[model samples]
Target chain A: MGCEEFELLLNGYIDGELKDPDLKRVEKHLAGCPPCQKLVRDYQRLKEVTAEMKFKNPPQEIWDSYWQRVFHRITRGVGWVFFLVGAVAVAGFAVYEFATDPAVEALQKLIVFAIFVGLGLLLISVIWERVKASKTDKYKEIER
Target chain B: MSLTEKEIVSKCQRGETEYYEQLVNKYKRSAYFYALGMVGSVEDALDLSQEAFIRAYRSIKRFKPQYQFKNWFFRILTNLCISHLRKKRRRRVEVSTEDKEGRTMPLPDDHFNPHLLLERKEIMRQLWKALSELGNKHREIILLRDFQGLSYKQIYEILEIPVGTVMSRLHQARSRLRVKMADFM
Candidate 1:
């Protein structure tokens, strides 16, 4: 096998993910190639050292209350959605009333109407752009 | 009989809200630790994992029975961490690892020491610092392969990539790490 082919198999060989024929080919290449042998050795040591490095355990209290926190978050998430929708609806109604009120100057009413329309369009455009990007982003599934 | 993960998900989609907790409890540790490895803080990890769970629960109906729920949930958690990292970097906020009294120490990128279990303290410290410095892709694959001990196939499932991609990515990650640790070697 070429050096490039052997290089591709090196990780799988070290990871024990290479199949028999490929593994034997890599082994034979390693026997004849000093550079490949050194690469494997280095990777093996790197793996051992990294394997030993572990994140410290957080306090047990975190785990104890984890579920509770998640529960509260889920509830609050629903609450926030309703709160936002209500807030937006109320604000939109207020703007609409101001725009239609007879006492308002024509320029002022037009400005309010323009601002509301601009914000609504902006929101839709942003959401549509996001949806389109998500469809095209190959890593979308990785992010779920 | 106890329900499988897929079965629990099916029940969750059917409006059995209580069954969702089973899914949470099943994968919470992995989810939290995975986020912790990515973000390098306990608080962010906790918050992001919980947030991911909420997102997953909200989208449970969209889940396919053919896929493993853990992988699906993990993907959500990973994306949340990536998004969190991007926002934190944009804001230039160090990870808040402060005491209640507000005393803080300066370190690289608000790093938390992961040398608690390693025999080689200096090496582990350098290893972690190098890991924190690596880009998101390299750091992620290193965490999955070396730290989490996930097989290539499992990494493939989580990454939604071909097995060859996993192998190549892992090799590149390890190579970058080796370069980063040249001083130690």
Candidate 2:
């Protein structure tokens, strides 16, 4: 194989992933080729430098409170779900009571009902826009 | 005797939530450091890593027993870091110089030579700066292999890519990194 072909396998060679014929071929090429050898040296140096670089360890308090923080987040998520459900239930019952009350005027009920319909439509519009944006966003694949 | 990871995961699957603490404790440093490497900020790394654990716990039932837990957790953590990077890209806000300077790795106490310590710190800082400038794929491949010390097969498992792709990607990433660190080298 020529240099270009061996170039592709050079990484595997350095990483010890090459075997048999491929390994022998790279070794033969490396013996004859200074550029390939230089490439190998460069990559090895990069690896060594990266190996020496480490992030500073976080404070002990972060570790001590780690599990507790996660647990609180989980419980808080559940709490928010319950709270939303209760809120919607209470609002629905109140709306039902107000609409059915004989003492309430027809115009007052109509105005209140219109306000809710407008709010619901606004919510749906916002959700639809977000879904559309998410689908077409150019940065979507960055997360992949 | 300490329970194996599989046994702990089994207990967690069986509704014993307390067993999960063991998994979290075991992998927290790995998770946090990986996040720190990707995001280049201490606070964001801590928050993102903890968020990944919360996400893993929420979906624990979907975890297949045949898979290694570290690889699975890393996949989740990596996705979070990538997504965080995506959002940061959208904002177009540069990481402040002070934040970067504040994150130097701790030098060993035995290295009492002041000049050597300063030189090492400078090299580390330059290395990190180069790393942060890389594209997401390049940066992540380097981190998974060089810094995290994951084997090619383990990297393939975590990345859900073929082994050939892993090697090629690592080579490309290192090449780009070499260009970035040309002055230091």
Query: Which ranges of candidate 2 are over 4 A from the true structure?
Result: A93-144, B93-120, B183-185
For model 2, what is the C-alpha lDDT against the true structure? 0.83
Reference-based TM-score, model 2: 0.78
Stretch of 10 with least lDDT, candidate 1 chain B: B88-97
DockQ of each: 0.31, 0.29
Please give the TM-score that candidate 1 achieves against the real structure.
0.74
Candidate 1 per-residue C-alpha lDDT over A82-104 given as tens digits, one digit per residue, 9 for 90 to 100: 99999999988997788678998
> How well does candidate 1 score on lDDT at residue A15?
91
* TM-score of chain B alone in model 1: 0.83
lDDT of 2 by residue, B1-185 (tens): 99999999989888788899999999999898888888877778889999999899889899999999999999999999999878765534332123466753332221112222123577676787788778889899999988898888889888899998998898789889888877766
Off by over 4 Å in 1: A80-144, B93-108, B112-120, B183-185
- Model 2 chain A: ten consecutive residues of lowest lDDT: A135-144
Residue pairs in collision within model 1: none
How do the residues A1-144 of candidate 2 rate in per-residue lDDT, one tens digit apiece? 688788879988877888899899899999999999988888888888888876556669989999999889977987999999999999999989999999999999999899999999999999999999875565553656
Lowest lDDT sum, 10 consecutive residues, model 1 chain A, at: A135-144
